[model samples]
Target: MSRVLIIESSARQQDSVSRQLTQRFISQWKAAHPADTITVRDLAVNPVPHLDANLLGGWMKPQEQRNTQELEALARSNQLTDEVLAADVLVLAAPMYNFAIPSTLKAWLDHVLRAGVTFKYTETGPQGLLIGKRAIVLTARGGIYAGSASDHQEPYLRQVMGFIGIHDVTFIHAEGLNMGRDFHDKGLNQAIARLAEVA
Candidate 1:
């Protein structure tokens, strides 16, 4: 059975554009793959704590030599990574906050992007351990940035996902949300129509 994991990081629980688009995409995806199982992790509602010095130090320790604290840290990291590894598809609802992803989402990334787990260092450079997984990122922005030269969100997101071996990544942008009602509606409509082709 195919498993899809959704990571939602919008602070606006029900009213977020990113979240809404993600839901639409998932609905379409489910319609296409009726037997797939979907799992959701809402980061804004249940935020993952930022990694601290203790947690960082704990991560550096060998798993067998870990103390109780280190063990707990390892367990948490393992749980996050395990979820990603087990998923056949990933959907991320990312809203642009200060031209980047929300901190809650970044915290989740910190937990899951563990060395020797999601990726590893080799003589040939760092290699991603996870493979054969596809990702769809639904992003919302205040202003119009679909094809602008200043839009950094899409490229940054692509680079980050690529770094973790998620090369088959697709982006759906709900941009110009804060511009005006007409622009917002236009942009959203375009995105929704495009979803039919991709999802």
Candidate 2:
């Protein structure tokens, strides 16, 4: 059975297009692979702590040298990193905020991308450790920005995912969410249709 790890970052619990996409994905994925294990980490409900001195110390210092707080931070990072490492498929649900991803999601990424755990410095260049994993990103945007330079979300996510050895990534964007009724209907319907095809 494949392991699927889903990270949900949308702040809106009631009406979030990203969350809708994830719900659909979960249903379809479960139907297709009945035995696959699915794990979800909802950042909106339980935000991961941002980078701090304690976490930094935990990452840099050895176990014998780490303090209590540092050890706790290290343990948290280990758990998050291990989830990513164990997953066969990774799904990130992001709702665009200020032309970028949510801060909560960014914090989660910071924990997951470790120095020697998820990536390593090599003689030639930095090498990723979490290889042979597939990632699917579901994004909800207020305006259309896919394939444009204004869309900072996809490029940033692609770089980070590739850095951790998840090179095969697919993005499904639901754009023009805040636009007028016509645009909203069209964009949402299109995204849902594509979701069905892709899921």
Candidate 3:
């Protein structure tokens, strides 16, 4: 059976549009693929630690020379990396914050996107290690910013996913959530319809 890893990064547990989209995606996905296993990692609930000196040292230092703090940091990174490595599909719920993705989500990405693990240097350029994996990004934005220069979320996410060999990625954006009731409803409905088609 396929394994699906979902990353939830919305700060608000209640009244979260990104969470709503994820719920719908989960329901639809389960209906379509009943045997597939799904795992959800809620960053807001238990946020991963941001990259620090210990983490960097843990990654760079030799195992025998590593200290306790570094070892613990490495262990945590290993767990997060292993989860992503084992998953067949990756789903990310990224609620836009100041025109970018949540810091928690970014921290999780930092843990998994490791050199010589998720990617490696090649003769031509850097190459991604994780292959045959797909990703789906569900984003909620305050203003309309899709395909525009101000839409930093999509482009950055696209590049990051591609860096890890997840080239087959689809983004469903729910924009204008804070721009009046009409825009909110329209954007949400459009995203839902797109998700329905995708899921």
Indicate which candidate wins on lDDT. Answer: 3
Q: What is model 2's C-alpha RMSD? A: 0.9
| Per-prediction TM-score | 0.92, 0.97, 0.98
Off by over 4 Å in 1: 63-67, 147-149
C-alpha lDDT score of every prediction, in listed order = 0.84, 0.93, 0.96
Ranking of models by TM-score = 3, 2, 1
Best by TM-score: 3
Which parts of model 2 are misplaced by more than 4 Å? none
lDDT ranking of the models: 3, 2, 1
Clashes of each: 0, 0, 0
Give stretches of model 3 more than 4 Å off.
Answer: none
Tell me the tens digit of each residue's lDDT in model 1 across 122-167. Answer: 9988887777889888888888776677777778778777777889
Q: What TM-score should be assigned to candidate 1?
A: 0.92
| CA-only RMSD, every prediction | 1.7, 0.9, 0.7
